[model samples]
Target chain A: MPLWDALSNAMRMTRKRRIGPDQAERLLATGHDPAHPELDRLLAAATAPPRPHELAGLDAALAAFEEAGRTRRPAPARQRWRVLRPLAAAAATAAVLVGGVAVAAEIGYLPGTDRPAAHEQLGSRAAPPSTAESGHGTASAPAGTVEPTHSLPVTPGGTAIERLCRGWDDRRHKGRPMKPDDLRELAAAAGGEDRIAAFCAPRLRPPGNGQAPPNSPPSATHPSPTLADDGDDDDQGEDGDEQAAARNKKKKKEDE
Target chain B: MDDEELAGALADAVRGDSAAFASLWRAQQPALLRYLRVIVGESAEDVASETWLQTARALRGFTGTPTGFRVWLFTIARNRAIDERRKARRRPEEPRDLTERELPGSHPDVANEVIQRSETDWALSVIATLPKDQAEAVTLRVVAGLDVAQTAQVLGKRPGAVRIAAMRGLRRLAEHDEVRARRAESMPPIDLQSPRTEGV
Candidate 1:
């Protein structure tokens, strides 16, 4: 048995242990263990009442509480609106303005506007022959001359100029003499004068019947959009170009 | 204050009586500071301040006796201490003073200073030498005057675990060389005096 237990038993026999829970707590806090003087010193030292300076934080803590109480409701609500208001406005503007223009362009309502006219001006500067003969070829064909037809089945959005270039390239491939006029038109159909090589190199490949590709800008300058819808028309246009070139070839052979 | 008076003050505080709230703070803050000192060292004061500010904000929604209030306040203090420790680790700033670096665990050598400051500071330093969980268990048990059940609630540990930790911590303190030497010089631990100690 420990010495403290022997001593505690002696005390219990002599006097009643009437200490309440609070007294027991006080004894523990004060480090009053009979068997351990070192623990007593340590606990008493550790649990001593804090001095005045230690409680200095009370005022500051209370002030912080008061400040938080004052700002709790209004600050976060106002801040939320401050952040979200501009974002909402910007989203609305993008949805209404940019989306409207794109929608108008898709339905062809924009072609009659100054944007397409500006594009035509740039196209004319790229190749001057097209500008000179533009009204004659676009309006009506001269006697025995092939008329430039906008009704010719093409990838939608392909201009009459691009189709004419494609037709001319087809004919040249079938043993017909390549025309200087046709070369000039190809340059105009390309967006810039420097782009003629890049533009014609891909589109002039002989079409596989009804295999019109998606309108990828670099894979061919021609807008081969709407393959399923325009496949039959593309086949018909290819056949017509081939037949025209075959006739021209036969005529040249006979003349020789 | 008795339990009735404490419950009255708490009710008044919940109703926005700052004076009543201050009374509660005065009663509880000392023990809270001691507990935080063991866990957070020199930053205990700052953490205690944060804890009170949070307690003040949430007091209206708080529904319990003064004992419950202590548990809640200490819980907040422990969480704030954890956050401070995490922030300190991420920053790794140079210590502002050599004393703070040497504090909490290292026993001060100046005999006069140790005697004078033993009231709270020296005791905290000794307790801080214990393992983190043991230190927390001892401080929450002895300093905060929480029962085993309440200390377990604050530490999120089982009652038996808290009791074991506190017992181990006390045993370790008893076994310390400094404490054992002091025990040799001092009189026996039993006090035959009446149980009318101040602040009990």
Candidate 2:
């Protein structure tokens, strides 16, 4: 048994020594090893070109790619919404302010003080007489009579004009017809059928412009206009008229 | 694909282009599969599929050069292979000897048949016989074409350790009886004075 152990130990000592780490690193990096050609053959075999079955999963992989692409497509849109949300919130606030002013004008709360001054400004501009006449007629009437006659027409008349402007814009873009009653009310407010376009042009221009017709009292143009609209129009004037129009529409809905 | 083409494809793939991503898969899949084969044995294909799926899912957000992309892909594959191995250890299925695995059936195309029966299979089987650390170090460094630093990163080892493991693995393969036999069969008798011939 001791002789057998000695022979095994001798065999172990004669076995090949391990290659240097640097040499192994070089072999792996460059795939060349003159000292060990067998290792070269082994690496060459290990890195053989893919078999047909190896790529059998390509179709499934690609399907996963497409599904991922589909899921990722919405990320940009979400990012866009991240940017647009604040602007939408501000616009919504402006809409509420505009709606409040429209309602104030309808209730005669604003027209009592602001409408006379607006009429005076329009009177100097030599605006449509029907609008100036109505304002002068209401201001000249007794205060007791003013609330009953003045408030009634101003309420429905203000709403009718706003409705007509929205309907007109929609009709131009969508080919929808206006309600006949709204058209007649708008005609009466303008004092002539032909003057409706001339009357609506300034009103449709975004609120707080001070150019709205005298009959609507231009409450958005009032010196003490709703603070939010005043602030938003100042801040967002460069955002363009389309956004302002949308804000105005939103205000009208909120007021209603 | 060349680096220039790979860069272009990577950019396009990040923008959700399937064709560009396909080119990437075709280029990297072979190396990835072979590396996984050495790391995970019979579960290599399943692990590879999981790797590609994960790569596809993250492709849109991935930003890197071609080399970095390859590293990222291999890192993901290695992590998934580790997970598979952990699960395999828990379940402990029946062990089938490597030689007992089914051989490729006969094919009509001679070249295809030869390829199926090539030394690659034998070499891979031999590599799979290595100790786990040495096999992984060799496979990542040689089969996956990673540098020592990269192999160390994949194996969570220091670069020095990886180099040693790889060296030891190569030395073991060099002394393998089958490897020596094949070398003898391929070459004519040489001078006995050669250092490698001293033992014999």
Candidate 3:
């Protein structure tokens, strides 16, 4: 028997015989079942003053939440408002779009549709051939028209006029938004005098409103706003002069 | 509840399920409070509250067995005790708060009451005087009732370290008790309960 058995056993009954920390720890860890006097103490200790009680504050917190539920008052309405808030905004936005499109159609603003003359006034439809038929079939080409001297540097086999025409033409062909820089470069290279190119610009009359693009002069001649221009549209149609104003407005807005 | 059901509840609690959390509080609060009482001494209530707050904060997905749950709870209690000790050290020494925590195995019969009470109280008081390693070992083995391995798990100390602590703690208690008894015997009994008659 171990020398400490009597003391250990007595300690055990009084709850002090559990194995000391080291041995129990070793036994627990290594599976080496060492004797535990202290563990005995612990078990004995466990049996002390045996009564259970509720926590001090648990009842209070439960009551607060309960009362909040009973009142049907503060948080739910606030939460409901919060939850429905985004829903309400979405509904309003839908209403505006449906109502807005109807209002716009009433004013004959729907594209390419037959409308009353009063509402169609702002449309940029191609003009009738009579406007350009001022006798240009054989003689629209003046004595100066055949001269290539007015053209700027174009690639080999490509004339300046052809290059100039490609700038606006490519924009339309590509269906890309024409940056102001493109118009400026084209205008600068084409070197002034041909106001026709400026007039054919699509911005002459905005679809939604009759407002013209801002900061844009009546003609492309007033210092091209952009530094880079790709000459695409070769010839400005007869209504080009009228359309230039609207084109400039849209272009200016694009720049902004 | 079966282990699975209990594990599920604990897992849910860990996952922030308030109902599961309430269940845990209901199930473990009593034993936990008692453990807290002994561990933190006087301010067991404070320590217990702090323990709950911390447990609530750190709760995550744990599927613990009953033993594991007790270990977890006691680990929390142990940490709070350490914090309390640190806080107390920052102030002056005060009398221990006797919160009458009921230990499951600590009570003795009337015949043994005087001796056991004196021994246990003396053990508890002297426990703090032991080397820290020894004190922890002794507390786990003697007070907390953890086996050596479980105590080792709680403490992260080697089993050897724990054994040394208990041995040292026991020796210290024996020494302290001997000294007290000797002192008591040498001195004349000063009985305050009896009338303080004038010196004859």
Candidate 4:
């Protein structure tokens, strides 16, 4: 059942050992091989007890987990690579893009792109941008508009088609085409209005402060524009020059 | 190593010193391997590896002398041996080859004439039929070099149990030997390979 009673002494060595004079002679006989002592010695060694040297796997497993922690932090480039790669790039890009997407899917958006997306994000004050979007050209969400680099309160959208369909319109309470000045104000408020078209490819929402879109510089931090008083800007092209001047000043500072 | 030395080595190892760990392993492996051979029987090498794996995991906590190390190491080994036994116990038992058919000495070490002269073959055939626990106990005590207490610790039993088990095991072996001796007397002892004496 064990191996054979010949090994009984071997077993007994680890348990209770009692070898009579005659019994000892027999074990000697059974272990008649030249290496019996060596083999027995080794077995004796094994039976002595396990020490720290024997527990390699558990130590290795713990070390491996620690090493893994070092390699797991998400990088910003990895995030963009994930989304842009699959949607706009090749299969290799897709693989990289997918990784970031998986990561971003849970954490909200990619890091650098976070600010712009938040700026374009509507009434959801939960979005964190404007403060974060300064020099960034990209918005995390496809919907918001890019503001002039100098201004703030930029509206955002994914595409012109999508943009036109967003928000309740004044005429029919349904979505309608946005005015040119509205785009200008958004350009100024967001920062670098020239990039508005590229940004418009994604659907975007209007700035919360009732400005002329991303085209104007912010006169105030908070958008306290009551809808009745602020809608007047929707009817005019008068604020265009003022915003353009502000954008020119921003460009000059950038060039310096 | 002595307790202080072993503890110092363990301290070094826990501090991420590979050399300390290596020294510990080297110092402990020989004895550990010997015990494993008796416990795992034929799969000594494999069980030795498992034992090392276990030791590696717990090495950080070790702070004992070489003697204490042996006890600690054997404690783990004894548990493993029991586990192996449990596994084997679950399997269907193989029918034993108990028939008294002694083959002529065929090992290269034995001369053809001495092989013909000795009772080696008959002895081997009979011993091969012994039960596993008895065989293991006999092998470790006779061959592995563990004292009664250490052996008991390795087998995860009281020293008394180890003594009893060893006693019974060796007694049975004596019975087998007597049976073989009678058989040998009837057949005549040929001059085979000289019987090898087991180590003390």
Model 2's C-alpha root-mean-square deviation from the true structure amounts to: 24.3
DockQ of model 2, rounded to 2 decimals: 0.20
DockQ of each: 0.13, 0.20, 0.04, 0.03
What TM-score would chain B of candidate 4 score versus the native chain B?
0.54
Q: Rank the candidates by DockQ, best first.
A: 2, 1, 3, 4
How well is each residue in B85-141 modelled by candidate 4, as lDDT tens digits? 556666787443322222334546455534332223233333334564455455446
**B1-200 in candidate 2: lDDT tens per residue?**
66777788989998888899998888778778777877787788888888888889888888887767777788778767766776787775857343344355454665664544355666777887888778877877777777777676656566777788888888888888877776667643222111010100
Please list, in the order the candidates appear, how each scores on TM-score for chain B only.
0.81, 0.82, 0.57, 0.54
- How does chain A of every candidate compare to the true chain A by TM-score? 0.20, 0.28, 0.21, 0.17
Task: Give Cα distance to truth, residue A74, candidate 2, Å.
Answer: 2.5
lDDT of each: 0.57, 0.61, 0.45, 0.42
lDDT of 1 by residue, A112-138 (tens): 232233323322232333333655555
lDDT per residue for candidate 3 within A1-256, as digits (tens), equals: 7868986566545523444555544432322232432222322333233232324545443343343233333223235434554564465446455565445333423342322332122221211122234447665546764322222221221122223344555565577655575454333332221221433333333334455543333233212133133222222211232243234334322110
Error of 2 at B19 (Å): 1.1
Clashing pairs in 2: A95-A251
lDDT of 4 by residue, A119-181 (tens): 244323322355345535565444465432322322323222233323212311334445765
Q: What is the interface RMSD of each candidate, in Å?
A: 28.6, 19.3, 25.9, 27.7
Off by over 4 Å in 2: A1-17, A81-256, B96-108, B187-200
TM-score per candidate: 0.49, 0.55, 0.37, 0.33
